[model samples]
Target: MNKPDPIPARLAALKTTPTPDLKQQWRDLFDSEPPPFNRRYLESRLAYRIQELAYGGLKPETIRRLERLGEELDGGDRSKRSVRLDRDRPITGTRLLREWQGVEQIVTVTADGFEWQGRPYKSLSAIARAITGTRWNGWVFFGLKNHRGRT
Candidate 1:
């Protein structure tokens, strides 16, 4: 097989990167709390950061286009990749996991909703809140959205 694209491969690696490592990176980059999102979210944002430093990020036209498609992006050409509206959201049976205080928490996507600890929940926010004891936007909590523009 042909060699994988280095950027995408690095992006994918973000999924399994250690939480403490990512957390330290977060501290170095943002100087704030690392949002309680899952690994995939962290990887995507970090990959964007890496790419922004290497190749220029999204074009302004792309950002405007994505805005029209109901997604917001940083107007600045930083940390964004190509935006494709046709892309599908994470599908059924996708397993999202995060490590919290030395315990691993898992959530699985289902057709109607999400499953956590063997029970069906209406939203990931519910699960996030249950996990952190604070109300959270599940999408952000799980890194379905980025902490900044164009991520």
Candidate 2:
């Protein structure tokens, strides 16, 4: 006879598990302290860990391919790799929209830089400054950067 599947139930429990208990599970599973991320992040990472333990993780070749792709994206610069690995950078061809003062602002991500108001910009802060007529962190202005742990 075949055994019952527990991975589905384990994954489901993550949705309802309390934060403290989830952190305990993280300690047990990862053998390390849980990251200082939000509950959603904890739940998602815990769910992935549960499945990975029950089944398996990516193959070596797949991981190598991903590393190669990262190197290609960042030109093998370790410092830049952190940014790419964080998945914070928007992909090319993305359209970021913001509304301010009853007007809609649009910025298009291009291969080289960003396009706002039919003009090329080197960084989001520049665009944000143009939009607000004041200095501002572009990522925060665009609602992309999370101000976690900031007073």
**Tens-digit lDDT string for candidate 1 (55-150):** 887899998887766534555554454542124445799888776666768889899989999999988889999999999877666666665622
Over 1-151, each residue of candidate 2 has an lDDT whose tens digit, in order, gives 9999988988898877877899999999999987654566678789988888888998899999999999998899888754431255688998877766646688998888899989999999999999999998787666565555231
- The alpha-carbon lDDT assigned to residue 107 of candidate 2 equals 90
Which 10-residue window of candidate 2 scores lowest in summed lDDT?
Answer: 80-89
Against the true structure, candidate 2 reaches a TM-score of 0.56
Off by over 4 Å in 1: 1-89, 149-151
Residue 111 lDDT, candidate 1, scale 0-100: 92
Q: Locate the minimum summed-lDDT window of 10 residues in model 1.
A: 80-89
